[model samples]
Target: MDRERLIRYLSLLVIGVAAVLPFVLEANLYLLNVLILMLIFIIFSSSWNLLAYSGQGSLGHAAFFGIGGYASTLIAVQSGLSPYVTIFLGGAIAAGIGVLIGLTCVRLKEWFLAMVTFGFAIIVQAITVSFLASLTGGWDGIASPRLVSSQVPGYILIEYYSILAITAGVILLIYLIFKSKIGMAFLAIRENEIEARVSGVDPVRYKLLAFAISAGLAGVAGALEIHYFGYITPEIYGIDISFWPIIYTILGGLGTIAGPVVGTVVLTILWDGLKVFGLTYERYIIIGAILILSVIFLPKGLVSLPDKIAGWWKRRQKKSPDAGT
Candidate 1:
């Protein structure tokens, strides 16, 4: 079979395994929690990857993430609506803010743009704590209604399946986008804005679109996380939230559909496994080292490792044949 077919089958297998994992493990509390967190990160990282794919990198995506959580929580509480219903509204709020940010940053150079986006998260945090203190609970945060209540007989399984389905749906949406005209425009813009503009692709329009979609999806992830936790805090916009997506996306494969998924899974495993050895800061240090090595050796990320090895073996075989002659 062709390589694409192989990838398709493999992806299906992974999804199937994840779908059944909760039942297989009998919903162990710790394991279910870990898996939930991983799924949330998968969404978060993929959202960040989408922005990056559009040639715009955000350092403060946690702003949108937190906004989604806060918005959903507030809406659910104030309106007495189900959390699931409010999640979309939360994402919409984030998308609006994202468009505003995109408008301001679209003209800036990479470094300036990064700094502005990074500072926006801090700004949002400050507003949540001080300006919006009345509603935001000012550092104390607020409670978010759960997607599936604990009163349900097998709530954990239900929640797990719901999140898994969301994960797949989001990924499928991204895949479809990548196959469409908008995706082509993003690639062109990323490669050369001047040329893309000449080619009738409006960089401004597409970039804003990217910003909105990416931020909205990130918000969805944050909403899910907060709902699962049944609480929210200013800490949701912390630097760690911002950085985790970057770590996962870069390690998986920048701009590729599967990069965030693979990267999040691998790093989550590594992070947890290493904790068994009682490492804290050392864990980050190791991650940094891996990233550096990856940049140098596997510039395309871990997804490309197999191809790199194959190329090396081919070169070795060719050299051996020539040497024998």
Candidate 2:
């Protein structure tokens, strides 16, 4: 079969498995909770990948992530709107802020842009705790409404399925975006900004649009997470939160739709699996080692592993024939 056809089938198989996972696991709340969080990170990681696709790397995505969670929580608390409604509103807010951030970043590239974004996260966290502490509740944090109240029967199951649906929808939306003309423009800008501009694709406008969309999606992931946990804190903007998506995207495959999903799932499993062995701080060291190894051996990320193996096997087969001759 052709590559595209194989990919399509594989994607459908993955969706099928995800759909049946609840029953396969017998609706275990702990596992469901992990799955839910994994799905959220998939969204988050995909958002980061989208920005990277535009050739902008951010080190402070937690800024948008926390902004979304806080905005959604605050709006839900004051307006008495459903968490569902407030999530989108919060994402919109993040998108607006992202556009502003993008304005300062469009001319910058690589680590310079990364440092600026990293600075924003710190600035945002400080503001959340010090200036917006009245509403944000400072480091103490504030309660958030659950996506589905625990009072409901099988609420955990409901929450899992809800999050799963949202995750699928987000991935689908991203897939569409990646296949569109806008996606082509993003690719052009990433490869060569001068060439893109000469070809009539405005780098500045597209970069800003990329920032807005990526941040908005990240906001949704953050909103989902806080609502799921039923709390929000300045800790939502922590450095680890910002780094997780970058790690997941890089490990899976940068600038690919399935890369985030594949990377998040693999790492989440490895992370939790290690926890079972009572390794806490040590797990980070192990994970770091694995990431380094993957970079050195499979720089295209796990998604490229199969192709790499296949090519290696073909080369070995060819060498063996020559050896016999």
Candidate 3:
């Protein structure tokens, strides 16, 4: 327990370093740019993690993410409004859509829910490209206003700080949710639906709430990404976008607050590092292998790795003492 506390404190220290890292790096635009994407995905993956923790995993979270992006982008372009304000509107729109989807999944479990959510992304993509092509600009995409105009001096620095602030707020919000009754309901539902119902928990309400919160934040993350790039496209609903978060959460540690954070950081490093070495497709192969090993050996995910090693060492020492050598 003392060791676990130490690990947590160390994690906090690492976060502190990350908070000020851009300044230390002299705000290099390229580096800051990568960090910005990473931060956005952190929020993105964390949102998915929240839903999975609630026993309602989504394979098509990109639907909400793209919806948020399109919604915010259209609102921003149409009204000449700030992306700042429109992002929230985007989140709300995504949340509403999420609730509608959740209503259909009220009785679903596991593979059924996953398949439906996966199909939802495909459906949303079709709608964007066909039914809404006029507004969505079809496949050509459309411009989105930057969070901060590039004309400003040190705009990149300003943008980085602003995104950092947003990421911090989202993480804090998720942390609070995890510690509340809402989180408990999610856990109860995840662990056992019948038992959760017997305990007076309403799985439908909590699942919908989880879906709303998860989708809304995913939408915000998507909005921020496209806004950062100053464009929006239907490709934002790609299956990769949905899968990446699940990968991160599974690799990091499911159901724990630190899992997504740890997973995202480690994977991001490995991803970019592999790129530098020109691995291309091989990087994914390596990552896939790592994922398999994690599942087989470290079922609790990477967050529990240190504890696993520590316990092994303690057992080894005990066996050594009993050997009488």
Per-model tally of clashing residue pairs: 0, 0, 0
How well is each residue in 1-325 modelled by candidate 2, as lDDT tens digits? 5998988898889888988999999998788888999999999999999999999999999999999999999999999999989999999999999999999999999989999999999999999999899999999999999988889999888888888888989999999999999999999999999999999999999999999999999999999999999999999999999999999999999999999999999999999999999999999999999999999999999999999999999889888857546
Model 3 agreement with the true structure over 1-325: per-residue lDDT tens digits: 9976886688578778878898798877777888889889999999999999899889999999899999999999999999999998998999999999999987898999999999999999999999999999999988899988999998877877788888878988998898899999999999999999999998889999999999999989988998899998888999998899999998999988889988998899889888899998899999999999999999999999988999998888878956545
User: TM-score, each model?
Assistant: 0.96, 0.97, 0.95
Best by lDDT: 2
Model 1: per-residue lDDT, tens digit, 47-129? Answer: 99999998998999999999999999999999999888888889899999999999998997678888999999999999999
| Whole-model lDDT, model 2 | 0.94
What local lDDT does model 2 show for residue 312?
93
**What C-alpha lDDT, on a 0 to 100 scale, does residue 267 get in candidate 3?**
94
- Sort the candidates on lDDT, descending order: 2, 1, 3
Put the candidates in TM-score order, highest first. Answer: 2, 1, 3
Ten residues in sequence with the least summed lDDT for candidate 2: 316-325
Q: Is candidate 2 or candidate 3 better by lDDT?
A: 2
